[model samples]
Target: MRRLMICSFLLVLAATANAAQPIRLGLNYPSTGNYKSEGLELRRGALLAIETLNRQGGVLGRPLELISRNTAAREEKARANIEKFAAEGATMAFGGATSEEAIAAGQRARELGLLFFPTLGYANAITGHDGQRYLFRETNSAWMSARVLGEYLSWHLPNRRYHYVSLDDNWGHSMEQALREATRSRDRARHGFSRISARGARHEEYLAALKKAASSDADVLVIVLLGQDLVQTMRLAHDLKLDQRMQIIVPNLTGSIVEQAGPQVMEHVIGTAAWTWRVPALVKSEQGQAFVDAYIAQHQRYPDSTAASAYAIVQQWAAAANRTGSLHSEKIIKALEDHRYSLLKDEQYWRSFDHQNVQSIYAVRVRSRSEIMQDRFKQDYFNIIHRMDGEAAAPNLDEWQEERGDELSLR
Candidate 1:
């Protein structure tokens, strides 16, 4: 409990007059719609963090509290939620299942004088072209995932034809483009493309897309879908026997998604994650392990990357708030920018330029059904194949400058 409460974010929390009061933290997540799995994880993680913090002592001597709003994976809903949070006196709000939603939330939070931390959104634009002073992305970007996954694919698959079934949203666009550039699949004719609706697609829609992919001569099927959408599509792909015909590539993978789709559907699938439940053990992170233990004790299962991200955001933000002894955007931002610490997996840092928390990206492969079933909880899914350091995996200054253009300047 002490390990969980006393994280790297706040080494010492100063006492205050209104210490008995509670500090509200807002969360904008998709509790309904396609990304509900991720949303539940966020809620579970946030609650856990709040419980732990309150158990010992909340940040700045005030109890941390979560005030969440359901975005349902929509940008408009996300924007509205931020407005509500600000009106409700939430000092900070963080959460978003999609990049578009995150961008909307963050922008609105900036206007409302509330800092926004996006926990799961992965578009390059979230921290690049669309970045604002009040927003910080706690997750890895599309470019970071592509950088490592592409390197592995180059050595393993090499010169392969591809087909992309992408979510028609901000995250999907950046992911596909980044992966294409990294893998040298710039030629349109060489690879097939099918854009699926970001909102839950109908059965017929998925059937049409997967059938086209099934007929294509592509050696790999890149799925840029997540949550329930991913579960439904993978089941459809399996029914069509597409999994056996070609290798499947999901840009991002979480234990929640795999558990929903089952081990058989996700078996041998390739992807990347910022942190997995198994990662803490691999990196010898006692704090991370304590988090995992607490989660398992409460939920009777292992926590996924979404949960890990949410917990990190809550703890880190609280720590920063305590460090500056204020919830004002300017002070908290200064405390977090260029902040470095070992959390969850490895040495991760909040970069000043783009406000992205850079960390190691692990290229993972789903274990076989037999192997997965052998586990007591059946959540030991990912086999970490390749680990890329944050410094190398993330985009360089030149790339950031190109994306931000005149909106950014050298310090």
Candidate 2:
């Protein structure tokens, strides 16, 4: 009897050891640079998703473990991180805070034949010009935001002349081009524009750009900047009285920006976001409410757009893998493409043609302190003005691919 008991104990120990081995998922984001706040929120969201999945039996009965690395918004660093993740036996990876880094990582991912999911990068090239079979985007593109917002602005403020001031980067250029194309057909849409490189630019340069936009005859000034640069530009624009002179619009607005810039600075500013915590549709949904509640309960703060997006992406990936009952990249990819999931306020699906997640885009107007205090969502600030359907918002994938056939080729 004693020998039999000892053998049973040894067998149990072996099973426990095998069960303890987790399937690693690599994550690289800008954890220590200018975009650290966004990165931290992303990590929090992804971690929360993993935790939830683990608590619910995990994917394919194997625990999912996150292996994180700080890319500092650098391309080479992101590339190295992907290689390290592959070397460390990570089955799949997610990250890329900036489009440049995301593109670099996508190239490396294809070379390594590793599945890569970009969470927050908005450059069209990731899924357009530089897309690979291994790369899938879980975030909205600059073109989507621009198309939706541009069409709305052209119709709503048809007579209002427009000018643009954007950061001189891949994202900024893509946004500018998208908006331009969307509004070009409208009467009185043409206006002067200025682009400033976010890197190594002097104060005078920023001031000059602001002054140039301020001096333009346009009534609406579209500022295509992100992170600290967006905040800095807003502050200087206020100082130069540019904000007061022209109606300022930010194409890519996030909750963190409103918190960082304060309600006062954001007051009267109009913008569009990929997602916001205050959407009435989201607040009313069962899944969305649970996610918000769990996030606030765990993090002691509301999840921003970045956090929500990252969380959704992780959950989507896990669900797809579980549905397919396989961790193989090809199987997972098949499960994701054309897969419909309801993680947010609206039902979303992965478009097979472009690998872009299709969901509603919100146009928001930042409310003043008085307005926010009186609202039902007292903690939330923005009033969602419009919700654009994802299909209408997305660019024509067929045309886009045909125009850039060679560019989109994996070879």
Candidate 3:
């Protein structure tokens, strides 16, 4: 009887050991900072992807686990999260939507030799940094987005002069430089219109500066602020009645910004981003519709561009992991560069040269409460006019270098 019991115990132990899984993933982003709303959305979307992947079957026949860390909107916290992720045996790190955070996370990925997949922050440096492989941006950079926006402006409203309202920071300056270069040759280009500092909580000062712009001949107002700043500035603009006169333009600002600014302020507000699930092509696809449905069911609301963008990136990451057949960072990085499969909802190619996941940017307009009441706002918050191809939008090394040069000189 004792020998039989011992044999049974040994069999149970061996079975348990054989069934254990190995690969782990880490997600680093702000869950309680300036962009907490967006950051949380990113986490939720990524978590959804992780759950879905695990449900089907994890990578390389092992159940995958995810450890998420919050940046808390602090650089030290962001760095700490990176170290923790590495120390915790994470082979790859997923992060970003803000340029500063993306670069900081990428730097850590470089030092630790972990693959970092950036979702939101579109700083140009990720791809440029002398061909660094540690960082890979799943979405187009602010550099590419700005260039596309500029070209759209030139093509759609050729005769109109352009004006820029940029925050005094790396993000603002890089985006501004992209626009400047895009519109460099135009004689009517209204360059250097207004420079605002993004270093405050309350935005009365920004309101006053914008009020002055309202008085100017600048018909096209390009705002480069997101989240609270985007909401507050739009609120002040509406209070000051700037929307009735000028065409307001902002890039990569999501629908959550619209919701936060409230229906009154966000009405007639125009913005651009990679892809909103609200778009028709996205809504019709299986993955796109499923993502939207799941997000709405879980969060009880429509997801903004920030949420959609992060979700798209998470899906891309999972697909790459599954295809690579290994959780090793180097293998995953190479798989990302290879980019074997297409995201069910995406409509563009992932360029191998710079690891820029190329997709068309969508331009959107906010609907009024009146419109929503009339049931006219059920459609996507943004209307899609065209899809810009990657080849058409990507700049050569020389152009990228020139843009960076202009940026350094500005500082």
For model 1, how does the per-residue alpha-carbon lDDT over 275-345 read when each residue is reduced to its tens digit? 99998999899999999999999999999999999999998998898899888888999999999988677
lDDT of 2 at 299: 71
**Cα lDDT tens digits for candidate 2, 161-239:** 7788888888888887887777672343457778888575667777888888877788888888887778778888878
Task: Indicate the residue-level lDDT of 174 in model 3.
Answer: 69
lDDT at 204, model 2:
77
* Per-residue error (Å), model 3, residue 149: 2.2
lDDT of 1 at 232: 88
lDDT per residue, candidate 3, 263-349, as tens digits? 667676665666676653553676777777877788776666666656666666666767876566677666776464445454655
The prediction achieving the highest lDDT against the true structure is 1
Q: Worst lDDT window (10 residues) for model 2?
A: 181-190
Q: What local lDDT score does residue 242 receive in model 1, on the 0 to 100 scale?
A: 90
Off by over 4 Å in 2: 1-16, 185-190, 280-283, 373-379, 406-411
Error of 1 at 176 (Å): 0.4
**Overall lDDT per candidate, in order of appearance:** 0.89, 0.80, 0.67
